[model samples]
Target: MVVKPDWLRVKAPQWERVGNVKDILRDLGLNTVCEEASCPNIGECFNAGTATFLIMGPACTRACPYCDIDFEKKPQALDPTEPSRLAEAVRRMKLNHVVITSVNRDDLADGGASQFVRCIEETRAVSPHTTIEVLIPDLCGNWEALEIILRSQPEVLNHNTETVPRLYRRTRPQGNYDRTLELLKRCREFAPWVYTKSGIMAGLGETDAEIRQVMQDLRGVDCDILTIGQYLQPSQKHLQVNDFVTPEQFAAWQAFGEEIGFLQVVSSPLTRSSYHAEQVRELMKLYPRQRV
Candidate 1:
């Protein structure tokens, strides 16, 4: 029998308002990771007035087993005007913080780096005071592409390790563990003034030691913010959950992360990488800037 954790049973506020948000996005003909990946926190995030914009296209070139994104043989053309449209959406939402991520476009020479830059420029043009966070891919470990994005200067540059290194083959077959570390390390190197962030999913058979090691690896890259959350299986084809991490365990991880010098750590059963991202930015503002 599959065990259901009590924490997952707690009632959350209704997110019917998200329907209105969805209508707005739909009328605009835009896609969101919250909707594409079927994120469990969509209701909470949307209800709280935040959303992670998905750009480039809905089809991802690389197929990660742990992810629920569709793999298209021939992905659609990049929208030249998506940045402005996204900026307009951000303006309409009146979001103080915005997170923009994209499907991996390995088909492009720059790996969608230019598109990221456009999104940043457009978002800043519209919402100058909004803090922008981007959850990015490894850019196929290309420093040039990564540099392009850093030059755009988002407030937070997040690239998820997703899971422990040992499960790379099963969880993210096309992804490289060391490459991801290099990506984060290079982000800090290229944009010393920008805050770096990364996240990992627990209950994917990652042990305490392994998770700790991942944290150390992230720190080695000079990552300033960290998020740890439980992995929920999106479909039968996706990776199954080995266990559901308890709220107390999540708290312990959060405390451990802070003790190890992470500026901010959000660890919980429902915590997603972009969850409470604005609050993370606010927390960082209280600290002394670290020399990159």
Candidate 2:
């Protein structure tokens, strides 16, 4: 493996703040994708008193090669208490914007969509002023399950495409490229009032033309927000990085996305699906057209 570029280096997290956030999550028995997935931006995001809550698991149903979240064939049963615990964390953290995501629970009947709805409702009951964003799975392409979560009325609904189509089989073996887009398309149709978001990781052996095509494809579905970032191999066992995308290239894509009519695009080496996600609230502020 090559040494990570200087641009990828992150300053160590301030321990005091990191501990505070961790204490809350631990005390509440809540999990965060930040720690579970080994996200590089954990330091900065957590210190700022925000987190993308990883509900429904520390385990997933699919073993995507590019992901660090653990995969389980027969995951444990859902915890009814999780929603209230997550709500308490949001209240204690005093967050105005919260991101809640979960692992694919294909083992369940509703694909765990009910848990998302419960979390949304619980958070609102406790902190009505706070905005909610849900990063969800494809639900094995179950549109009905998707609708269940959508009806909860989250401010932003996100589902990551993760990688370009051609890489789906090898990188995301259990994932279908078209199924992902179709989910986003249906989300737009189901809740046009909600801001729709998707994410893609570069350095996975995809070409510029392919990336641009993805940006175009996302716009074709009326996707409101896009996030592009470099893919760092989690361990020697995981897929190796193909290339390190340069800052200039990320800047170029950011501009290109705007040209294609994406309401907001966050592209950078360190950017993750929910990295600096609280700032998504600014989209409506900066671009009135995004007020949908």
Best by TM-score: 2
TM-score of each candidate structure, all chains considered together = 0.95, 0.97
Q: Per-prediction count of colliding residue pairs?
A: 0, 0
Q: Flag regions of model 2 displaced more than 4 Å.
A: 286-292
TM-score of candidate 1 relative to the true fold: 0.95
Q: Residue-wise lDDT of candidate 1 within 1-292, one digit each (tens)? A: 4666877653564657777788778877888999898888888877776788999879999988777888855788899989999998899889898999999988888889999999999989988998888889888878998888887878889999999999999888989999999998888777887888899999999898999999988988888999999888888887889999899999998998998889999999988888788886677679645533
Give the per-residue lDDT digits (tens) of candidate 2, residues 19-137: 99999999999999999999999999988988999988988998888888999546889999999999999999999899999998888888999999999999999999898999999
Cα lDDT computed for each candidate against the true fold: 0.86, 0.92
- CA RMSD, predictions in order: 1.9, 1.7
lDDT of 2 at 269: 99
Question: What is the alpha-carbon lDDT for the whole of candidate 2?
Answer: 0.92
CA error at residue 131 for candidate 1, angstroms: 1.1
